[model samples]
Target: MPKSNVKKMLFILSKATIENVYAAFIMANGARMEGIEAEIFFTFFGLEAIQKKKLEHLHVATVGNPAMHMPTMLGGLPGMEALATKMMKKEMEKLDMPPIGEFLEILSDSGCKLWACKLAVEMFHLEEKDLIDDLDGILTIGDFYSRATEDNTQMLFV
Candidate 1:
């Protein structure tokens, strides 16, 4: 047996919320920068980030989150999710942060693998056409575990 120099990381993202989705990308990109091999498997609500049909529906929190406060009840209305997302995007832009889609593309281009969970796809009735084109493939949990079994590999659930 030989020690492997490369580190393998499996990131499981299940939340579609803005911060959670962004955090997944941040971690993936960071891992790549550290010379680690990283794979992200989007499942459940997290699928929205890679699904063309649902990508635009991603949202941020303007209210009810302990860290944030809504100035008025109207600020927390049903349509406010979009507003909050937009506001957050603008703030990120000002900070020169990469958009979620662009960040994912960069990660793929840099050799980090992206996968959509097969069980989630079937459960949501999602077809291949629904996913972003950058995904390396659709994988089952067993498939992911097989890859993550290598020495020094780390698995994360978010």
Candidate 2:
């Protein structure tokens, strides 16, 4: 690990939850504002957070999510997640937050690096071409671990 003046903030996103992705981006941006080198790694369902086709359709877990205070059984109900997603979007809009894609674009422009997981891409049969254009790169778990373990690199999973 190389000694540096700035810290590396690594956020590993393994879910597709709207809140998770939003929080990661928000934090990454915040870290950059403080002069940190921040990056977000999208893996598993989290890949949906960066996929071009799934960005706007992202949703919060409506049921079986302790945060939502709903029972697990309710998660099986159709359209609940969708309903929650709509409500969340409306609330965010009221607060003047940009849509997911725009948020990503702003983050990218702000120098927040974005990466996708290699294994997850193959497991989910995803094509790199379908992801947003500004991603830093697709990384294997081993490579990610090595980089994340560098001195002053803090790994956060959401």
Candidate 3:
């Protein structure tokens, strides 16, 4: 491709939960690997993925999610969310996958732009101190769109 034809991507992550955040990380990593100029905009629930206070509290679903089936009785146990999340992290470690925090860090280091939505941040009462240090800045929807409108830039809402 010509220099001007380089691919670009704008990832809008609207869900801050574990599964969704992981998906966003994977997509950003993949886009970077393909030489795309990638930007990740965290909004609404998605902001949780990048928030220092809530990042570790993310959980994996072992019950209601059809893709995963924990032992029926185990599913209803009191500490199920914590247990499932721990188990999932262990599994990921066994596969040599990076933890979510480190994954985000790697992407940020590799030139992926990370932004938090200003409106969502205010709505959630989140200050800049609440967000992970790697965020480039906070932006409005219009600011995000202005950057996303570049040629060959793909926008994804997760």
lDDT of 1 by residue, 22-132 (tens): 888888888888878899999988999999767756788666675656565666778787877888989989988887778778989989898899999999999999899
lDDT of 2 at 88: 88
Residue 143 of model 2 has an lDDT of 76
Off by over 4 Å in 1: 1-6, 71-75
**Residue pairs with clashing backbones, model 3:** 16-45, 16-46
lDDT of 3 at 137: 96
Candidate 3 accuracy as TM-score: 0.87
Error of 1 at 144 (Å): 0.8
Residue-by-residue lDDT tens digits, candidate 3, 1-158 = 54546588899999866788888888889888888888999999889889998887888766666666557567768888788788888987898878878888999999999999999999999999999999999999899999966677778999
lDDT of candidate model 1 versus the reference: 0.85
